[model samples]
Target: MQLGTFSFVTKLAGFEYTKFVRYDDEGDLRVIKAENAGPHGFKTTNYSRVRSSSVAELTRSRLHGGELLMVFVGAGTGNVATVPEGKDFFLGPNIGMMRVETDTVSPRFVELFLRSSVGKALATAAMKAVAQPSLSMGTIRQIPVLLPPAEEQQEILRLVEQALTAAAECGADVREQQSSADILRQSILAAAFRGELA
Candidate 1:
């Protein structure tokens, strides 16, 4: 099934990318910058904040938890992510958003498909601009979508999530081992210097 046929609500935030922030940890809104938008989930702790005066804009631009956020410009052109529930963020510029109209499609399913190799190829081909690669609302809408049976879609998303969780655990384990090795080496060196390792 093609994407444009749905009651899908797609949008590109106002032109002010994630800029001009005096980050306040306790700020009301989390401003999604192009840099923090990733293939997995976002790096929430490192994002910018929405000022009190500008906070009203969030009423319109704030994410409703399940929409897929795509980087439409600069180095992150084709990357996409869905902000987790309970946390809302204002869409920054160069970022295009696809609000999941779940009655017709699942948000996680759509996001996972778009992040796949074939989906990325479609986005790469549709993108424009040389200096700062960008995608317009029209170009994004034109990208092809392959809709599988609902059961198949659910299974794929479940498996992918499980694999990602395992991979992340392995990465953390590797980092922990590396840190332990470094500390062991330092202790060995200290002992040798004190003639205790002779």
Candidate 2:
């Protein structure tokens, strides 16, 4: 099915009001700020826990797997990330999650599309100028997306995964080479200081 066949949210996901309950005796929930939120989808090796006294605090939008979380209204506006395996995280108010209908569209394909330059362009244009440039739900919903057949979508996803795997290996090799260069430089410096090389 095509992307246009799916329904779009009139408002940004997680903009609704909800109740929050404090989880801890200490006021740790109040200290849980948006700064602790990480950029969606950029797989990083490290993550810091968001301290909160309350487990039921409704500060951000709840997210599920197979959803696209876009930074709509923040310093990271226009940045897009897909939810990885499981669900059980909240998105800061600055972020908006796009839940595509799995029946109509392929989530994996849509994610790869959003990560493309064309998708970035659309998101960039949708951003509104404010204290911090933000994107309105209406603007995001209006962004045109091209959808292909389901079979085509699956093939595309397979190709993308293969490409990403190769890219990651190349990046690792580059990092190893850089580390080797650094070690050689350190050895030369130590030898020169010790008068081992005349």
Candidate 3:
């Protein structure tokens, strides 16, 4: 399979918020900004939205699941997130979309790779050397992706999923221990304050 830009993705574009579009608090569609692209996934809290009717013209920018959302500019440049399936979200400004083109390659694998250290280093090197250090569509298109066989890619994804699940469980255990320590410390402080620490 061709590994060029067009081989993996059909669409590589950025959306811009225009003055003509108005944000609505009660809108059904959510606009995902850079801040929404969190470490785990897209965070929906406090996101801006436009009425579905108002953004009919921008339906092209609407995410249809598994689209890799990349922050092409600003401090968080190179950050990537995948749009969850069935989410009613539109690509907000400063973020670019890579709509996977081929079924041979899994979008989840690509997203995971892009968020990896090696992948991030590749993206970092592709950034413009100007004052702003933004990644243009042309540059993003040129970023090389390591494509293994389909089975291998799936295996890698499975391994990564297991690692993440283990990490999350470890994190939860640490938090629980910290909470217990905090309670013990508080109890000790209370006892000392009440002159019961003899």
**Which candidate leads the pack in lDDT?**
3
Global local distance difference test of model 3: 0.76
Best by TM-score: 3
Q: Write the per-residue lDDT of candidate 1 for residues 55-161, one digit (tens) a residue.
A: 55445467757767778778888887777678777666667777755574777877777788987887678677588888877777777778777788888888999
In model 3, the Cα lDDT at residue 193 comes to 100
Q: CA lDDT of 91 in candidate 1?
A: 64
Task: Please write out the lDDT profile of model 2 over residues 1-198, one tens digit for every residue.
Answer: 223346333222342323333233333222212333244354533233333434344434445455566666667676666655553454445556667865757766776676688867765775676798887766777767778888888888899899989999999999999999999999999999999988
lDDT of 1 at 54: 56
Candidate order, TM-score descending: 3, 1, 2
Per-residue lDDT for 14 in model 1? 45
lDDT of each: 0.71, 0.58, 0.76
**Model 1 regions more than 4 Å off:** 7-9, 12-27, 51-60
| Candidate 3 stretches greater than 4 Å from native | 1-16
lDDT of 3 by residue, 1-198 (tens): 222453333232433355335788988888878786666655667888878787677656777777877788887888888888887787777777887777778888877887889888887796877877688766777777888988999999999999999999999999999999999999999999999999
Error of 2 at 105 (Å): 1.4
Q: Kindly report the root-mean-square deviation of model 1 from the true structure over all alpha carbons.
A: 3.6
lDDT of 3 at 55: 68
